[model samples]
Target: MMPCYSGYTKSGDKFFICGKLGPHCADARCMDVGTILCDYPVGDGKTCDMPICESHAFEAAPNVHYCPGHALMWRKFVDAGGVERDLKNVVPFAAKERT
Candidate 1:
């Protein structure tokens, strides 16, 4: 299963939004402030929404990032010579139209 994060501040006031100092990294081991969200598409037109720090994020493409686990999966897919169209089918937003 994919890792995810969702919670509020200690005061139970501020909600966690990855990238800000308020939220922590989704990776349990790291304590660094999250810098971005995993771009991996989940379902129902929603993304993984996994909070990831700079060190834990892997750029699959420009402005497209994946969490450590997803990154490894992506790497394996690429290594196996996966098709780009297949990836687009999974994450349409990550691909842009060409002129």
Candidate 2:
């Protein structure tokens, strides 16, 4: 009538639970194995936003992430005189984009 645990380790009198047991991508739609951190922080400010596989990881700005499709879209946006807004407060594109 006792439950069994696989990742639990007992050292002396203390027990520790192993973190992640397997590899998983941060993007819910992705099926590829994760290999890199997106480098963008989530709202919690403690963990990276996306754990992407090599194929999905787009190097937009050195260490930043934008995905392959998004990278191209971002380039077009910048080319049209659009600037990246602050993460804390996002404004309308019409107001932020330069003519």
* TM-score for all models, in order of appearance: 0.61, 0.38
Candidate 2 residue 73 Cα shift, in angstroms, is 7.0
Q: Tell me the tens digit of each residue's lDDT in model 1 across 15-97.
A: 43344354677788776667699999888998887888776789999999999888888899888878575776694456667
How does each model score on lDDT? 0.75, 0.54
In angstroms, the error of model 2 at 35 is 1.6
The CA lDDT at 56 in model 1 is 79
> Against the correct fold, how does model 2 do in TM-score?
0.38
**Over 4 Å off in model 2, which ranges?**
1-22, 27-29, 41-48, 67-79, 83-99
Model 1, CA-based lDDT: 0.75
Where does candidate 1 stray beyond 4 Å?
A: 1-20, 84-99
Output the TM-score of candidate 1: 0.61
Q: List the residue pairs that clash in candidate 2.
A: none
